[model samples]
Target chain A: MRFIDDFRNAEHVKALAGSIERRAAQAGRPLRFMEVCGGHTMAIHRFGLPQLLPESVELLSGPGCPVCVTPTTYIDRAIELGRDGALLTTFGDLYRVPGSERSVEGASAAGLLEALVVYSPRDALRAAQDSHDREVVFLAIGFETTAPTVAATLLEAKRLGLRNFRVLSGHKTMPRALRALLEAPEVAIDGFILPGHVCTITGARPFTFIPDEFGVPCCVTGFEPADILASIEKLTELCGPGRRPALENAYRRAVRPDGNEKALALLERVMVPVDAQWRGIGHIPGSGLDLGPQWLEFRVEPPDPERPSAEYSACRCGDVLRGLIKPAECSLFGEVCTPDSPVGPCMVSSEGSCAAHFKYGSQTFTAGLAEIAENGKGY
Target chain B: MTEKTIKLGHGSGGSLTRALIEETLLRYFDSPLLAGLPDSAKVQLQGVPAAFTTDTYVVDPLFFPGGDIGKLAVYGTVNDLAVVGAIPRFISCALIIEEGLPQSDLRTILSSMRQAADHAGTEVVTGDTKVVPRGKADSIFINTAGIGAFRPESALPDAEMKAGDVVLVSGPIGDHGAAVLSAREGLNLDSAILSDCAPVTEVAQAILAGARRTSFLRDVTRGGLVTILNEAVGGAPLGLLLREQDIPVRPGVRSICELLGLDPFYLACEGRVAAVIDAESAPIVVEAVRRTPAGQDATIIGEATAEYAGEIVIETAFGTHRLVQMLSGEQLPRIC
Candidate 1:
């Protein structure tokens, strides 16, 4: 609480916000920026960053929320295993995310499956070791930042030779998603505020493509609003519609290009790139990582479509993921798709745009989103 | 190592001191009066009876994320009374000061305590102070008690939660835990992740105002919501059903929880509150709690019923279901 208290000098945030607004006016006609870290998305939402920013400078959330991007079939697969009588294990966020007709929480609450919510992969591995009778499957979902842990887990499982232990690998690579965002014709992003955590793992090199090929200003930023503003300044100042890639480290306090080599190496040994299926975006060709042959025992497959499933057809989560609309833009947003009764994956994940827009983005958050969706255009 | 034997310091009026009371003595001996024990003993009088309790905080890092020992001590007692249907009125304060704590830091903490107390609409009533040798204690330990007017419940262990009784949480989980984790370890992300450490009596009072057929109410602390769901109905006939997507957790908290390998369900949240009420009243109470700042993110996490015959299970996001058992050991120590 003390550390936060020190940071709460709100005047500083105001000063920073003012500076950003001022800087944006002189910088150009309009500036577009996106934060790749889910944490940054949350912080921006928590602090009301959008409302404070100048009208010309737009803050759009990218594919930062992991649960939002998680395909529905994966959840169905997880639910299937839970129904097939395996003890499902995952972080709490994954527990609430719906696959098709239900979530792991529903299965656990309904007594159809055993959901072991754990704090770490160590705990999942420990559960696999301690409970010989139960089938423990770790529902792995994250970016390259968290990819190494799964590597460590699989290697540990291999060492322990725990037969009951498996990982439903829904884990993704950050760079791939970023590339998909840039390549999309519908999206016209001017600058990128790269992910801090993911960069810490893959390093700034992975983002070199955004600068070299796409010619978009790429600045790896810290989580703070000031950090974001500072990164935005670098991005806008450096980004002059040129056909050259630029690599910048706005979060220099922590990130380096090579990143944690040990972590990267650990991931390299245990995993390899494979064609992954995105829920709303469809398959983005090698956008996901699959366990290597040695780790096949821990492999996960897409869930069966035949199982009992439920979905509120009106949820426009597909639009939200592709940067076509915000969460409130969905017709079912707060009415049918409140946090309690999520209609789509974005609504299901707490960090999703729908959740953010619904929870904090507006006096009536959905109004702006609906208008944007109605316009059928991207900024 | 069973944490069986108690030391002399266990009675030292610090956090571990209370842990001794809760973990060792209270575990084997919990009754209405004993269970009701808070910062101070409450004796009901005619006009407006109030509940009160005091706790001494000795967390290793005196302050982290959203609040500190002083703020936690204030909100803890206030929330305890509020959960039991009381309007927190005033609080008594005392400090067991470590001999060499910086005066400025102490002033800062005291000011924060005042601000938090003021924010909660409770005034500091009476107090005491004690100083000990430097190594004798952590940097600082705050002991505070709050009193609140008890609403005329006019009920008992009454109408035990039915099979369809809904379980509700005041707001998102793991704010305090993630905030503390980041602050304690100096893990910098893009933005500041602060603790959700504050009182919720005003919101709790609102939920209680709209009386419904309720069996029990408890704030998920120490063990998180998972622990509360496990203990909701002591009897063998009660069943607790939870829809995974219904539960809310801040995305950052979830990601950090994933990164650190922690469970937000088991993570500590000072501002989050939970209660077992009639299924119909959950949304009503959620709406009521939403009126307060702390309860803005309130949601109905699950329901309690006479189904499982006596166990807690959570469905995974992947669609499978499993049991959510009580934490046998500490997940993250000194996170309050």
Candidate 2:
């Protein structure tokens, strides 16, 4: 009980909450803050951190969730495999996501799905070997933190000569998304709460450009409230009066500025950069990873595309991802688009700024947070 | 239409997607629930309801072992309202479709949603739809808002937990999350693994028959039963205890989690709940669930303690004690 309770030093959060309010009050201006990890989005929502903060301090979501940013084509390809009797495997979080008109779960219910919700690609390889009679297609989706595991899976699959397996990859890099996000027209982001897991894999080099080029402060923090508070303090220091943007690491317990060399090495060996489309953000150059030509044997063709009879309009999700508008401000927020029938990418992913705000009431304290964090889902 | 490779626009809510929804969606889920042309539905509530419950589903791969998004949505909303002793009546489905998606698949998914709604005895009633540019959306995303009827005598309180109560689960723990994880993560265990995403209204009503002995009831969603248990027992004068062996887990789920270095307790569960019953009526309450289809797999997993008020502990297989914390973020693909 003590160990379980130790993880939550709620009292510290309470104290920090008071201090943050005091600091924001003294500044008398709306304080802008962004939590750059999808996990943080969920944590803040789950813990109701937005409710805990003062009206002047605005907490915004950034482009963080890999699942949220992954393009529909990758999912459609995975869904196609599921429809074709191929045993499609992926993270469980993807199972409920609707592909076009339905999700992998809906696809499975109709006898057109072989989607398995997996924890790692290593498990996918093992499944391929076990189900020797059927093809196990791994739907690889993640940022750099998870790509190495896919690499290891492929190496092991080849080592064992598993002939009944293939992969549909949409693994992406983090730096590109961050750069694109900074240029989005939705909100004027003052600072960033960099992802801790991605940093553990790619290191600080990928993010240094943010501060150097954009003049915005970025802090890498752990999931704990203390870690988040410490990161916030670091942001205030870098962005305060006469302060310039900079990169600071608050998660020193695990993340090193240099990152894991061996993981990066594996990534370079197995994959290469490809022009990828994010679910909300448009085509970001060199933002995604694809299997090297040598690794083509690991990939199989995906499902057929269902082209819209007419040109589709801008979903507004792109604007939302870039912090363009509040979910309610959107034409199709709660009125026409609930999670059951999401119309844009922002509502599709739980970590998406619009979806997070819609699911949990985060707009209550956001008013006094003027010009600081203006948009919930900006383009 | 000749078979061709799928493009991202299929999910977009344009002409092609409309074809899928109209042609295929109307075929199965042709009911009033999914027929709505608005973002959200406005219902009369049929005479002033006391509580409002909204839930959203964003499972990846969208489809997995047992059920797909269609059934998951229906059951998810039904279970959400049912946990509070409400019989889910009216519901709405909101969809976000990625552009360049296929029509054939949409038809398939809509049909499945209809089937799930039929099984759960709920109506779709109203829904919304939107289309994003090709890269602006995933295949599809569904959010469900359900309004239901809760009997005045059977209201489930948010913070009504008390001490000396017994905790009961409808069925095996972690199977739904683990099954999904195995299929998604590709752990590939020899054992068959399927998600437990059934509607539990029947079982819930059975428990409510003796609701007087119950202090609090909550569905084990998102963060799972440990999360609910932690929240239920915490800030109260009682502690909860569970015998690890008493918590049922399937062979494939255990193997998948063990192989992946994950724990089964933190995974999501769609068709289960943790009901705190008076210690004397625990067995009778368990029997009530045993008689129902959804609760046939139910078991008494833990009990509340007077000591260490507001903490959950599990007696491990090693005869040692360890505390169970609420899931921090998401257990991700580990669900069975």
TM-score of 2: 0.57
Candidate 1 segments whose C-alpha is farther than 4 A from its true place: A1-12, A239-245, A302-312, A362-379, B1-336
Give the per-residue lDDT of model 1 (tens digit) for A179-293.
9888889987778888888888888998898878887878887765566666776766664443344779987767987898999899889988876766566666677777888
| Angstrom error at residue A75, model 2 | 2.3
Query: Considering every candidate listed, which one attains the maximal TM-score?
Result: 2
Candidate 1 docking: what grade?
Answer: incorrect
User: What is each candidate's fraction of native interface contacts (fnat)?
Assistant: 0.00, 0.17
TM-score (chain A only) of candidate 2: 0.87
Question: Global lDDT of each model?
Answer: 0.70, 0.70
lDDT per residue as tens, model 2, A97-211: 6555566666665666666766678778878888987989988878888888888888888888888989887777889988888876556877888988889988887899989
Against the true structure, whose DockQ is highest?
Answer: 2
Tens digit of lDDT per residue, candidate 1, span B105-138? 8898888888888988889989888899988978
